[model samples]
Target: MHELSIATSIVDIAWEQARQQGGGRVTGVTLRIGRLSCVHEDALRSSFDLVTEGTPLAGASLAVIEVPVRIWCGPCNAEFELPGIQRFACPACGHLSGDIRAGRELDLESIQIAPDQIAADTPEAKQPEPS
Candidate 1:
């Protein structure tokens, strides 16, 4: 349900980029999703498919780059990626760290456009602006 809104927002951004690029056909979208971001990949993919229906982004493939949670170890003085989201302790020194280095991202990384293809999907489909 929340993924649906996120998908809608992604499409909106893609549309704006497409329009800026002279309305090229969007073929694919890449998203960087973190483990701690609380976004289900399967649900997001399904929502993307639904939101893209009959729009300029219809048939666009969605690719997700899964990022693992990483934290900075102060005692060890290094950053390590956790094997899972179970604990936030340092692997080497066993020190607990509240300094998070990464793994809280939900960003639309890139968009692929096909210039050879004409923009023709649904007749009345206009790219909606992001609210």
Candidate 2:
């Protein structure tokens, strides 16, 4: 599945970010998933677990925040959550419109890590040889 590839990319990005500041094991990753992103959360989590094995993010947790599909309705003069993908009409006035406001985000919000944790995970000799 593409989840594996997506997970791989996420890990790659997190790993690079962690490694940049000397080196640190990622503890968690926060992602914003949109309602229309069409990504399966369960599959993504499973793929993340499998892909993170043996990597810097091995024990990291994946936190996914669900985003709702919203549209701006001229009839109502406001934005409202869509009941479903197909119904793009104003809830109050029943006016059909396609003024989409949000719900297409697939982003990595942040990554958490501990410096000491990274040092502990690193090989001893690879570390500085006691000055």
Candidate 3:
């Protein structure tokens, strides 16, 4: 799936950053996804998980931020959110314009990394090591 490829790209970028930084493991990744970007959030997340398997980014959380679709209406001389994909026309004047303001972005916002003890889940202590 394309999500697998997208996820692989994210990990590759994150790995590069980690390498440049000299250390530190990735704990989580934040993504800014636009509605018009056509990137499936669920699929992307799942792909990321699959690609991160056995890598430094393993167990990392993928957080997605939703961005709304905004367009500039030349007829109304105002910017507003598009009601839907089919309704790109201005709500007030009912005219269409090619001035698309936003809703076409796919960027990585930030990456959070923890030192050695990154957030990890483990089984019970098993009654301790017994000194």
Best by lDDT: 1
Q: Which stretches of candidate 3 lie over 4 Å from their true place?
A: 117-131
Question: What are the clash counts of all predictions, listed in order?
Answer: 0, 0, 0
- The whole-model C-alpha lDDT of candidate 2 against the native structure comes to 0.83
Ranking by TM-score: 1, 2, 3
Model 3, residue 78: distance off in Å is 2.3
TM-score of each: 0.87, 0.82, 0.82
List model 2 lDDT by residue over 1-131, tens digit each. 98888889999999898888778678789899888888889999999999998876776788888888889988688998888887888887888888888788888999987786545856533222222
* Candidate 1 per-residue C-alpha lDDT over 25-128 given as tens digits, one digit per residue, 9 for 90 to 100: 79889999999999999999999999999987888888889898999998788999988888889988889887888899999899988773554543434434
How many steric clashes does model 1 contain? 0
**lDDT-superior candidate, 1 or 3:** 1
lDDT score of residue 64 within candidate 1: 88
Candidate 1 structure lDDT:
0.86
Compare the candidates by TM-score and give the number of the best one: 1
lDDT of 3 by residue, 28-61 (tens): 8888888888899989988898899899888787
Order of quality (lDDT): 1, 2, 3
Answer with 2 or 3, whichever has the higher TM-score.
Answer: 2
Question: In order, what is each prediction's RMSD in angstroms?
Answer: 6.8, 8.1, 7.3
